[model samples]
Target: MTPTRKRRLVAISMILFAVGVATTLTVFALQQNMTYLYTPSEILAGKVPADARFRIGGMVKDKSIERGQSLTVAFVVTDGDGDMRVEYEGILPDLFREKQSVIATGSMQGDRFVATEVLAKHDENYIPRDVAEAMGKAHQKHNVPEDAAKPSTY
Candidate 1:
């Protein structure tokens, strides 16, 4: 084969090899770090795997907190239709309170969720910015007061 043709073939082979290696690495990384979000109802319905790490988001059940020794606090998080007990051993967010929305990350053990991290949703009408406009329009349709319908700026 001509020298220029041989060089071109070698360059193309190297590019193909690099692309294959990159794709393989990306797939491996994704497999090791994938997680899913589930509501309390989905968890109770057996949609979440027992040993897989995932996120659960819902409202904190009223009067469900049980203060344990030290920094440990146990609470039940509910998504209207179902509830799951969560054990967290750290300082909870300042905004963490009854009936507030929260998202917890961890794996399930039996029927309980052993949370490794917890994040409390801020404000009452805490819709995403993109959805806020739609929510505002809907609230106006129902004649909700402007201040009452708006979320707390806190």
Candidate 2:
């Protein structure tokens, strides 16, 4: 082949290789930095990596909250089958109450979740948008109102 043609082909191949490398690196970085949400039972079943940052969602067990003189609060999060204690030192959401759904984010330290943040469900009928949408579809399949059976507002 001519030298000029060979050189052009090599340059094109190099550019394609560079693009592939950049794309792969971007994907790897995103995966490494992504966080996932799991339920309390999922955590108890060892579905989560021990040291990776993730979230756990469940109902805050009734009367499980222990408030200290300071801002520290300890509570048990349960997903029916299992429970995990979480410790946090920040003001909880206004809707945070006993027996309410909550999502805690952090890492597992031993058997406990040292939560860096806690998100409480807003109201009785208020599931997280994602959860609500999923449940809505499920309810539609079963011929039920998505919000009809929700706990009464009082």
Candidate 2: give the clashing pairs. Answer: none
lDDT of 1 by residue, 19-104 (tens): 99999999999987987777776787788875899877777899999999999999998766668899999999998899787888
Off by over 4 Å in 1: 127-154
Candidate 2 residue lDDT tens string, 45-112: 68887699987777789989999778999999876656889999899999999888888889999988
RMSD in Å for all candidates: 8.3, 7.1
Worst lDDT run of 10 residues, candidate 2, spans: 130-139
Candidate 2 lDDT for residue 11: 100
Give model 2's TM-score versus the native structure: 0.75
Which candidate ranks first by lDDT, i.e. highest?
2
N/CA/C clash count, model 1:
0
Q: Please give the CA lDDT of all the candidate structures.
A: 0.80, 0.81
